[model samples]
Target: MTSDTVPVPPGGEILRYAAFTTRPDGGNPAGVVLDASGLSTERMLAIAAEVGYSETAFLIPGRAEGTYTVRYFSPLLEVPFCGHATVASAVALAERAGPGHYVFATPAGEVPIEVDKDADGVLRATLTSVEPHVEEAGEADVAEALALLGWSPEDLDAALPPRIAYGGARHLVLAAATRDRLARLAYDFDGLAAYMTARDLVTLQLVWRESEDVFHVRDPFPVGGVVEDPATGAAAAAFGAYLRELGAVTVPATLTLHQGDDLGRPGLLHVELREGDARVRVSGAAVAIP
Candidate 1:
């Protein structure tokens, strides 16, 4: 293998942080390894499993400043991209390098991130996703998803419909007709995992429209070896593309996503869609876990 085959020493530092929310206990927690230059893929995978979060990011510094080669790993396997982990990693970098722009070369593509502090001095990150696109989920796949989720046809929102959305990763978007239906999420984990794996899906984006520009969302991430994800940046980006493509929301719109409230780890995600822009922008504030 390449230099990535070098082993990582035991007791190497790992940083824990939450993304998409300023509070430590609110957003999705991710493990950040800022200096993973000599880490092998196997070592990174083991570290990620030990972290026991939905995802962890490994950073290998590039020759140029503010640029790095990044890799993401779930507890079970390597993923092409991870939104929360990216935000967490960017915030971690900003803490060291000061707030500015950073370029991450991921397996998916080059992801540009902007880091700036809010008026309250809280660091926020905005990641511009790779070119996003939506594909029809098809009748059979939607039916199978509903069956595994223990939901029926009437439970789906007619306006939203079922579709496979992709930003940096692919997610199956299913909108519930009511907030109650979305809140009562009990699913056949093994069955859903199998189905999702077969179709190369990252998570099931379960959503409920709370208002014209606001939504409540949840992510079932059995494939990542997590029961659920409190805040999902990739899914939020895909959802923005889904809305624009389906004409559900007008272009140049900024939508707010409220997630993890049901799990008691409430996080907020801001999604922006510009007119004639295929890529989506997902913004959130992240904080170190103390």
Candidate 2:
């Protein structure tokens, strides 16, 4: 049956958690429905809007233990996969069952998440992405995107160029020549939303390289009905793939992404690409939003 035709159960209780940080005020907040067995598609969208986060996760019991079927919804639409919400939901489950491994059957694919406590006594979850791929973005498309973002072609980093990258979802990757260029992000909401909608893009992964392994990034998520996403796990995963594809980073490398600082909600994302592995791994800590 088609996704739209699938039956949705009734609504369940919703919990709130912030992913990628230890402090409740930090990281990206997401709504988590631990038992969404009864939620319908329409109802889920309503719940997501009510939660008012970038995205919310709904979990249904899976066939096996430590497994669950998951769905992600933004305020306005259902997404194929949501990284922050996935991390948040896994930690929520881990808190109840103790830190361990959990399998989430997302619309994108089977994602395996491992939750464990670090030395700092923080609960962190690492998610293995599905097979990732990158494609060269058309020059015309890049021009249009730059216009919508109020960015000039000269502001773009020629070394990184522009590309469309995908892990669980697609993102348009744009590298800025300088941190200053990336920081002054003022965009036309309607124009960008239209462009992104036409391309089925989740966000624009605007970034600037800080050092060999450190980078500053931001995501413009007009498609998700959010002005900006403080911490974007999906984009980070896709960026890992983008770097690997472009040979920008050596394999078996780990990178640190700092985001949401400009928005005053600082977040950190750890991305790792293992040797001989095609899928990227993203890890971060989460906290319950009280």
Candidate 3:
């Protein structure tokens, strides 16, 4: 059904939360429909589009308590998974149900989420990603992506090669040689969106490594019908896997990601990798937008 024909349920409230930051204006904002049992796919899409956030999450209660079947939709289409929205939804649930563990059954796979209050009395959520993998990006595809972004091969960081990374969703991981290069992010939206659509990529994880464990990043999400994602938790999870697979980071280590600074909505993402597990864990704080 077209967005114009989609129906809004009576008194259906959409909770707004900013994921990855305690402040409402900081992290990536996501719409959480706590009970979307009656909503159709088209209805969910229309709601997300109306919300105008990068993504929104709809939750349907599972047979067991503390377990939910979740769906994520960008303004344009449904995505396999969305980390920020998961964080937002988990925290939202915690506020109503009390903090603890919750499992989300997403299109990609099952994700376990843990919610707890920190020392500062702020609620934080950590999500264990589905099994992740990294694959080599075809040289031709990389060149095309770079061309669309107006980036030259020389602007790339040779240390961190281009690759396709997946934690819950897929992202093209590209590293910039300098912080300056990463900061300048004007790209051909239409062309890049087409490229990403052809490859089934969710976003381009453009990054600049500051230290072994700290990095600054950005994500261009034209295919999702957003100019950019201020803070991308899914991409951060994918990046954690990328670092482990590339042997760029020590196992059982925690890494820090700084994002959305350029957009004036700075946020932080904590990524953890355990020695025995291939799955990545992404943690962030979320606050309700009043």
Candidate 4:
């Protein structure tokens, strides 16, 4: 069935916790509904509101063993898919059921997730998204976005032209030319949020590349009722797709994304692009929140 037409369960029954990086206070946070067998849209929305984060993930056991269906939500509303929350939920399940592969059936489409322990025993998860797409932003949209962000066209990096990218959800990717330019982040929340909402955007993926394979990134999630995201996996995955489209990177590549430093909640995201597979792979460690 098409995700657009897929029905949300009546209401979920369990609540679990997942810490995308380390303890609860660090990294990105997400709510995990371990077994959402029968959940309604309104019920899931309420649960997400109570948990209160940029995104929360709900899991349902799938047809096969070791597989599951997953859904993601923000405090404000339901999103098609979420990467950080997916990592969080997978790790949480691994800790309990042991590390393995799980399938997520999201509003956007089917996502494949796998969890395992690293050499240091850090629980990390890798999620492969549905096929990704990128599009150019209209001049008017870019102007409005820049005005809200308090940035002019001069602040942009010509190397990375502005565009809208999609992996799980849609993000407006804007590249900053200088580190200083990316650091000084100030925006009109209301204005930007309204603009994003009208365009069905989840966040503004603001970025600055430090080297060939490393980047510094930030996400303005005004539409999710947050000024900024501490860590963003979904956007990172979308960015990988964007890079491939720009011919900036080749397939079967691994890229590093650093974010949340300005807010003091630093996070690291690893992304992979496989040859012959258009899906983006986002990997990160997740720990329990005490």
Error of 1 at 248 (Å): 0.8
What's the lDDT for candidate 3? 0.94
Worst 10-residue lDDT window for candidate 2 reads: 1-10
For model 1, the local distance difference test gives 0.93
lDDT accuracy of residue 101 in candidate 2:
91
Ranking by TM-score: 3, 1, 2, 4
All candidates in order of lDDT, best leading: 3, 1, 2, 4
Cα lDDT tens digits for candidate 4, 27-89: 787777787777777767777777677787877787888677777878787888888888888
What is the per-residue lDDT of model 3 for residues 63-88, given as tens digits with 9 covering 90 to 100? 99899999999999999999999999
Best model per TM-score: 3
* Segments in model 4 whose C-alpha atoms lie over 4 Å from true places: 1-20
lDDT of each: 0.93, 0.92, 0.94, 0.84
Q: TM-score of each candidate?
A: 0.96, 0.96, 0.97, 0.92
After superposition on all CA atoms, what RMSD does each candidate show versus the true structure?
3.2, 4.0, 2.0, 5.0
lDDT by residue for model 1 over 81-132, one digit each (tens)? 9999999999999998899999999998999999999899999999999999
Q: What is the lDDT of residue 121 in candidate 3?
A: 89
- Count residue pairs with overlapping backbones in model 1: 0
